[model samples]
Target: MISIRLNGTEEQFPDGSTLAEVVQHITSATQGIAVAVDAQVIRRTEWASTALRPGAQVDVLTAVQGG
Candidate 1:
């Protein structure tokens, strides 16, 4: 098991889980969603290759229409 901070809350995931998998596990709506790891924004194309490390901070942000 691996520990990560998801949107400010501590969460656990299987070791070697990619960012893409994590996003899917959390939600199915992929459109307009952005991800950042350790305070760095990760490009959409890199999600599948990005691996979440223990103690890493992850932020999942979604776009809002009414701004």
Candidate 2:
């Protein structure tokens, strides 16, 4: 298993996990948020191809709706 930091919290997943997998781990409330890894914004199409490494830092940002 590999250890990764998600939005300042430590989490673990099996080795070779992809960014898509990370999205699945988050809650529905945060599912639509943007994801950044190691300071790089990740495109949705690349999520499945982006392999995560141990000690990686993932930041999830959500869009707020207001009128």
- Give the alpha-carbon lDDT of every model: 0.90, 0.87
| Ten-residue stretch with the least lDDT total in model 1 | 58-67
Task: Give the lDDT of residue 65 in candidate 2.
Answer: 84
Best by TM-score: 1
Which candidate leads in lDDT? Answer: 1
- What is the C-alpha lDDT profile of model 1 across 1-67, one tens digit per residue? 9999888889999999999988887779878899999989999999999998899988889977785
How large an RMSD does model 2 have? Answer: 2.5
The estimated TM-scores of all candidates read: 0.90, 0.84
What does each candidate score in C-alpha RMSD? Answer: 1.2, 2.5
lDDT of 2: 0.87
